[model samples]
Target: MKVIVTDEISEKGLELLQKDPRIEMDVRLGLSKPELYEAIGAYDAIITRSGTQVDAELLSHATNLKMVARAGVGIDNVDVAAASEKGIIVVNAPFGNTNSAAEHTMAILLSLCRNVPGANSSLKSGEWQRAPFTGYELKHKTLGVIGLGKVGGRVARRARSFEMDVVVYDPYISEKRATDFGTRLVDLDELVQIADVITVHTPLNDETRDLITAEHFAKMKDGVLIVNCARGGIINEEAMLNALNSGKVVGAAFDVWSEEPPQGDVIRQLIEHPRMIVTPHLGANTFEAQTNVAVDVSKEILNLLDGRPVENAVNIPRFDPDLMAQMGPFMELARVLGDFISQLAPENPGKVSFQYNGKLAAYDCMPITVAGLAALLDRCTDQEVNMVNANLVADRRGLVVEQGRSTESEFFSNLITL
Candidate 1:
C-alpha cells in the first residue's frame, strides 16, 4: 500500500510507516490544489495537518484512497460528510494535544494578567517601566470554564492548583463529573456573572458561534478577563473589543481567531490594543504535541492497513465479517423494530430489552441487538452510529440495555420483541 504525506509531520511517524513492509511512503509538501489532486490517485492513504484541504474535489481525484488521517484533533479542514459518502474512513488524533493546549491556555492567561509580553519588550528596548505592567494575581479569583472536555478539564485542574475557584459550564457533563474535577457546575449566565476570569474551550458551531456576545460581556463583572484557546468564533471579536474599550473587560488573550490571518480594522484594532495578547494559533505547536499526533495518526493508519479495529474512526464502523454475515438479515429487522418502537413508545426511555425466539435465537444475536441500538440512536445524533459504539453511546445517554434469547416460538417459527 502506498501512502502520501501532503503536509509536514514528525520524522518519527514517517519512520513508523516505512518500517511496515507492505507500505510505501512519499513526502510531498506545499502542493497546490491541482498538483495535490493529480498526486492523490497513486496513494492508498494520505496523512495531513490543517494546511491541507481534503475537500470533495480532492477526494474525487483520489481513486485509490482508502483513508485520510488528520494529525490533530480538528477535522474542519476535511469534508467528513463527503468522505463518508465515498466510503473513505477519516480519523483524527483527538487526545494527542490535550496537555499542550491546556498548558497554552494557562500560559496565555498568566502572560496577559502580568503583561509579561509588554514588560519584556519594554526592557529589551532599554526602558524600565514596572509601574505600567502592574497586574493582579490568580489566587482567590473565580475562573469560569466552558465545555469541560479534555482540554478544559485539565485547565480547571491547573487553575485549582493556583488557588483559584473554578466554575464550569458544560451541559454534556454530569454533576458527579464536575464534583470530581472540583468545579461547581453552573449555567452560562451564572458563570459569566460571577467569574473574575473566563476561558472558553468549546468547539465552533452554530449554537456557539456567538456564545460570548455583547450581552454576555455586559453581564460580566467589571474588569473581567477573557481567554479563548479552543476555537475562533466561540467569542465575538466585536463584542470583546467593545468590552475592552469600556474597561468592562480589563484584558483578553486568544490563541485562535475568528479568521486565521484575520483582515479588516476590527482584528487590527484588537492586535494593537495593549491589554490584548494574541498568538498565531500556537495552542498545539509544541514539539511534544506534534510528535504525539504524528504517532497517533501513524498507528491509526497502520491498524487500518492491517484490518484492525480503530477506536477513533469518525466516518465508519468496524465489524467482524463472519459475525456480520450471520446476523445480516436479523440486523435489518432489528433496526426496523427499534425505529418502530421508538416512535410509538414514550419519550426519554430508560431501558430496552430484546427477546429472540425460534431458530434465530440459537445464533449469537448480540450483533443484532447492537444494530438495533445503533438504529435507535441514529435518529438522535448527527454522529455515525454503528454496532461497535452503539452500546457505548447508549450508556453515555443513560439508557439501560439488555438482551435475551430463547428457542421457543409463540405464533411464527421465530419471534423477536423489543
Candidate 2:
C-alpha cells in the first residue's frame, strides 16, 4: 500500500506509517495542481490538513486512491460526496484539538476581560498604563456556554475551577448531563439574559446562523463579555459591532469570523474596534494539537490498510460485491425508513432500535442496520455519515443502538421497523 502526505504532519505520525512493512509512504507538500492531480493517481491513500482541495476534478485523476484522511476536524476542503461515489473513505481526527480549542477559548476570554491586547500595544509604544487595563475577576461570575460538546464541556470544567458559575444552553443535552459537568441547564433566552460572560461553541448551520442577533444582544446583561471560539456567523457581526459601540457589550473576543480573513467594511469596522479582541482562527494552532491530529489521522490510515473498522470515516459504505448485490433494494427501503423516523423523532435521539422480521431475519442484516443509521445521522452532522461509520457516529453521540430479528410478521414477508 502506498500513502502520500500532501500536508506537513508530525514526524511521529510518519514513523507510525513507516512501521508497517506493507505500506510505502511519501511526503509531498506544496504540489502544483497538475502535479498533485498526476501524483495522486498512483497512491492508494493520501493524508492532508486544510491545504489540499480533494474536489471532483482531482478525484477524477485519483484512479488508485482508496482513502483520504484529514489531520484535523473539518473536511470543508474535501468533496465528500464525490469521494463517496468513487468508493473512497474519508476520515478526520475529531478529538485531536479538543483541549487546544478549549484552552484557546479561555485565552481569548481572559485577554478580552483584562484588555491584554490594548495593554500590550500601549507598552510597546513606551507608555506606562495600569488603571486603564482594569479587568474583571472570573470568580462568582456567570459563564454561559452555548454547546456542551468536547470543547465546550472542557471549558465548563475549567470555569468551575475558577469558581465561576457555569450555565449551558444545549437543547441536545439533558439537565442531568449538564449537572454532571457542574453546570446548570437553561434555555437560550434565559442564558442570554442571566449570563455575565457568554461563550459560543456550536457548529454553523441553517439553525445556528445569526444565532445571536440584535434582539439577543438586547436581552443580554449590561456590560456582558462574549467569546466565540466556535464557528463564524453564530454571533451576528453587525449586531456585535453595534452593541460594542452602544456599550451594551463591554468587550468581545472572537477566534472564528463570519468570513475568514474578513475583508468587508463591516468586518473591518469590528476589527478596528478597541473593545473587540480577535485572532486569525488560532483555536487549534497549538503544537500539541497538530501532533495529536497527525497521530490520529495516521492511525486511521493504518487501520484502513489493515482492514480494521475505522471510527471516523466520513463517507459511504464499502461492501463486498456479493453483499452489495443482495442488499440493493433493502438498502433503499432502509434509507427511507431512517429518513422518515428521524424527522418524526426528537432532534438528538439517544437510542435507535431496529426490528427485522421474516426472511430478513434469516440473512445478515448488519448492512441494512448500518444503512438506516447512516441515513438517519447524515442530516444531523456536518460530517458525512455512512454505513462505514454509522455505529461509530451513534456511539460518539452517546446513542444506544439495539436491533432485533423476528421470524413473525403479519403483513409482509420481510418487515423492517425503526
Cα RMSD of all models vs. native, in order, equals: 8.6, 9.8
Q: Per-residue alpha-carbon lDDT of model 1 for 237-265, expressed as tens digits? A: 99988999999999999988877777868
Each candidate: what lDDT? Answer: 0.87, 0.87
Give per-residue lDDT, candidate 1, residue 257.
80
lDDT of 2 by residue, 18-48 (tens): 8889989999989999999988999999999
Model number with the top TM-score: 1
Off by over 4 Å in 2: 32-34, 316-368, 371-418
lDDT of 1 at 43: 91
Query: What is the number of backbone collisions in each predicted candidate, taken in the order shown?
Result: 0, 0
